[model samples]
Target: MLLLGMAWTLPNTLLGLLLGVAGLARGARTRWQPGELALVFHRYPWGPGGAMTLGNVILNTGASLEVPCRTYACRAGLGTEPPVLLADHEYAHVLQYLVLGPLFLPLYLLCGGIGVRNRFERAADRYAATGRGWWPWPAPRLP
Candidate 1:
């Protein structure tokens, strides 16, 4: 039974490693310029008297602008910085979308086994709605 369990876990471990490598490579190729508004990483659950926090920001100079974000709870007692982890997690989704292009949405739904395509979006909305500085910033108004 132990051997069988190990065999089952091996494939997943290898796949995760491959995905990590791919994400790192993709991140290396992408660059952000100054003065471009982008979403940064924010950690902190929607709880009473929580403060808003952000880790990083995404930016672009040209017309093409995309930011993808997601939220997930970290294991208790880990004591790691939440913003960093959230930034990595959200950026991974954005990277996947960029690398995979249109196919990303479909592939994500298929592989994630989620019933809806907006599952991630919904989660992001809920996180943002908590008012911990998750509010969407409208386009900058011009005078």
Candidate 2:
């Protein structure tokens, strides 16, 4: 299943690798996170100081798994503190990529790109703060 997911998101993952490699030339560092099944590139010099997830890759301006903003930090227990769950948020995106494959990009844009209004981002934040609700759409009830 992991392999299938990887293959499903290969296109975006390749693009992520291309960008990540470029960041490496400018002092970025990468680490393979088996748990998340993603390659994280930290200290990426090009962003406006935040993280972006493409398929199974995460590009971070500060440090990997650190929240890019203070929006719900207090609620998440990461208010001006260490151990942020930014990784978990981005992991939600990875799950989306796996399920949607290449369609994730287009659908994400259609859903509002990135911001509070974006269901994807909102869901990701929800998952980070709480251990559930990662799926952007409501879960189906069991019979």
Candidate 3:
């Protein structure tokens, strides 16, 4: 089971790390919460709040972008915090990353064409809407 988990998540782990580095270089900030995953908040000041980094993970720029990552998620909004629904939606993507691993990207791309409700998205949407969804996220991602 541990091996399966790793196999399913390794790609996102590596890719997410790289993007995280890029985001940090781009002036993004990371917040780590105990008993929960950390999130990278972008601060560049562009977009409506959502962007995909490295075509793998979700990045929150400024508005209300809700996308998923591996362990963490970056959401968009304004003020001091992003909306719970947005954060939940992105966090659900994290769960999908854990389950799908490298396959996650291909599946998301192959089916997620223009947000037409592909299988990958449907599963993620379901997870994010669950009672256990929505981990605390940050202000935003890179500009």
Candidate 4:
């Protein structure tokens, strides 16, 4: 029984680690320079129940702007916030690259990851303008 459990658990653990590393690598490949912007990480313990109960905030800041946002998943706990191994800016840009299109590439390359993140941050604002919240987790506080 122990051997069987280990066999199953080992592979899963390795796979998760690999995915985490891949995510980080993608972030590093698109990091921004200092003074250009900032990335903030926030961990929320009071998340929903089930597969996505944790939350994280990504903040980007430059000379005249600041963007703050959150993303969450339940099953992963607080650790799911951009994976601690990855820089918040890098992680945010990776997400932008994934969600946005190649239009973000020039920003990512020229202004660095911070620019890509800013574009996505603006996108999120536009999304919010539709009056629909994009967060997937349950409401943090119930009425």
Candidate 5:
């Protein structure tokens, strides 16, 4: 299943590798995050100083995942905002990428690109908080 997912998201993963290579040229370092099954590049000197997930690759603006995950609490507008682990949030995205394959990017943009209004992001946060319900599309209930 892992190999299948890697193949399914190969295109996006390739794009991610290109970006990672560029980051490496500028002093960024990388590590394989086994838990997430993703390659993470940190200390990347670009972007808005956060993390961005591209398929199985995760790019971080800080030295470690915790650095960016702890930057701000992941609040789902539930009155009380609790800290959401960025790693788990990003792993949710990887799961999304696996399920959606190449369609994830286009569909993500169609939803709202990025922000509180994006259902994808919300679902990811929910997954990070509760460890389930990552599927954004409605699933038929099993009888």
Candidate 6:
């Protein structure tokens, strides 16, 4: 991970900065917490639809996303399902970024057209499902 981070220096730094910025913005928009990584809870505001939120987890896009970026997930006024599942799953993506470094996004996009990129989602989901995270056991069932 260290080598990859270094190998992708400029790109990863820019992406990480973007992610960090989003994390700041999201935190300002809602409640932000620090954990295994960063967390934006309550509500997510800032997207193509003027803060449009489709699901629990909102992903950051672009070449700047070569690294793990800020993920917007809701905590309240969203639904009854626990947000921890989303958080855990997202952190798994961070781990993926750590492993793949700059290759994460390109590979993710090439695979995105298929099942919201099932390959990546499955790994994250599986990680969340394991209950090996900071939250509870049994992640929320997703489609």
lDDT of 1 by residue, 38-71 (tens): 1321221222311111112322222233333233
Best by TM-score: 5
Give Cα-based local distance difference scores for all models.
0.33, 0.80, 0.49, 0.30, 0.82, 0.42
Residue pairs in collision within model 6: none
Residues 43-137 of candidate 6 have per-residue lDDT tens digits of 33344321211111233322111233222222223333333345566666655555566666677667662232346655664565575442212
Off by over 4 Å in 4: 1-106, 109-112, 115-117, 129-143
Worst 10-residue lDDT window, candidate 2: 75-84
Write the residue-wise lDDT of candidate 2 on 1-143 in tens digits.
97898899999999999999999999999999876778999899997766888999988887667454443444445445333377787888888888888988999999988666678887787777676887899988999
TM-score of each: 0.26, 0.85, 0.57, 0.21, 0.89, 0.47
lDDT of 3 by residue, 46-113 (tens): 34445443223445574344443322122222123222354555556666565566776776687744
Cα-based lDDT at residue 41, candidate 3: 50
**What is every candidate's alpha-carbon RMSD to the true fold?**
18.3, 3.8, 11.2, 17.1, 2.3, 10.7
For residues 1-143, what per-residue lDDT tens digits would candidate 4 score against the true structure? 43443343343334433443344433312223333222222221222311110011122222212333333221224323331212332333333433333434455345333222343433333333342332222348878
lDDT for model 3, on a 0 to 1 scale?
A: 0.49
What is the model-wide C-alpha lDDT for candidate 2? 0.80
Residue 136 miss distance in model 5 (angstroms): 1.5
Whole-model lDDT for model 4 versus the true structure? 0.30
Best by the lDDT measure: 5
TM-score of 1: 0.26
Cα miss at 102, model 4 (Å)? 6.9
Model 5, 64-117: lDDT tens per residue?
875324312234444455667788888888899988889999999999887767
Better model by TM-score, 4 or 5? 5
